[model samples]
Target: MKSILKVKNLTMNFGGLRALHNLNISINKKEIAALIGPNGAGKTTFFNCITGIYKPSNGDILISPKGNNEKINGLKPNIITKKGLARTFQNIRLFTSMTALENIMVGCHCVTKAGVIGAILNNKSTKAEERLIIEKSYFILKELGLEIYVNELVTSLPYGAQKRLEIARALATEPFLLLLDEPAAGLNPQETNELDELILKIREQNDISILLIEHDMKLVMSLSDNIHVVDYGKKIGEGTPKEIRNNPAVIKAYLGEEVV
Candidate 1:
């Protein structure tokens, strides 16, 4: 079980305030790992650092896409995505004016080889690549059960479907590791359950590792192969779901009570 993502001595600072403190975490190949904590616990900050949205003040963010390790601390976000890491935001960030298919095609840009010249000249290779992008985008829509909304604007889709579309776009990037940020936010119980199933399907079908920051306890407990709990920018617990559910520190800091 090789780790696809590894963070060592991760720390983030905002002036005198420390958002994250010497945090260390990892997600293994094809595993669904959850980062759980109360709000403002630096979970999202950690994600931002790893994704290159904010360069960490101190630490190493390492990613091994296919068993080759590389430090990604200072890489740009798009560069990180091209290195096989893609993420969704806590709030949906779709191109509202774009159709669902087009939104996904936007993510495929990193993998496509068409440069400015190719696009202007409309060469055979560029045309073929454009067709492949369309074809692959359609396949992603179908795979996520979003074919019905393919031609619809993201603004017009239902809330749950909009969430799915965000994930579909991330998938279109062909990520080896997907970082989901509070994906079940604002969903009804039925929608949350649907998301749970969809996440499982993603793991099994795509064989992609997942590292998610979620506060939805049921979804996290049920979906995660391993759970890491953070409190006030420090790791409070890390273990299997069952172990985390019973850990006294996790209960006191975040869980508040026994999970069962």
Candidate 2:
């Protein structure tokens, strides 16, 4: 398959209640996909399953490995992330006490192979890695327009910048796939526009595939190459944005228009 993410017959449960039922989805390499749905529609639960926060009781979640097929469903979250998957949270989760650069440095820990002994002893190998890691952190910070904020404590940055920093930290993980959960949550129109542009830039420039969970209809419709609509924990429709916009089932799920 040409799909980077292939979720087949996936199911999730919380005791007796079902969250996702035989969910089948595929995201191709470098494709931007959006998952939009009403509140409590299992969107977050679905994300949880995909990213390894919860293991499915059955089925497989396969991610094309840097270019090979890898079954990633059973792995732990960190392990999955190490295998080139990274995600940002709906809630900002930066370390407020650490400088923005420091937070990013912490994220590079996943890719760091040097043991703590090597890290602490200024071992030659570790020292060389340190230089490389710090350089990468700086490059990512500059790319996200947070170079000036690099030395500043994360808590001191403005809300929008903080959001961007969170994203940068995720990027520093150096993953092929990025899961962005409500990136435009608190942004004003200007910041939202900038974010839209940044996301497009990331896609076009970096060849990054994004799976987004966003409530902002404008952002979702404008940014997505394909769209999935879910309601009451079930997918009512999936199609291109224009197709989704005209889907009566989806429209009635969000905006009640009497079906003819």
Model 2, CA-based lDDT: 0.88
- TM-score of every prediction relative to native: 0.96, 0.95
Q: Determine which window of 10 residues in candidate 1 has minimal summed lDDT.
A: 251-260
RMSD of each: 1.8, 1.6
Once fitted onto the true fold, the runs of candidate 1 whose alpha carbons sit more than 4 angstroms away are 255-260
Task: Count clashing residue pairs per candidate.
Answer: 0, 1
C-alpha lDDT of candidate 1 relative to the true structure: 0.93
**211-236, model 1: which lDDT tens digit per residue?**
99898899999999999999999999
Report the number of the highest-TM-score candidate: 1
RMSD of 2: 1.6
For residues 1-260, write the lDDT of model 2, one tens digit per residue. Answer: 26899888888889998888877778888888999888888888888888889988777998885667789897899998888888888889999889999999888989988897996898889999999889999988998899999799999999999999988898888888888988999999999999999998878766789999999999999999989888866779999999999999998998876655
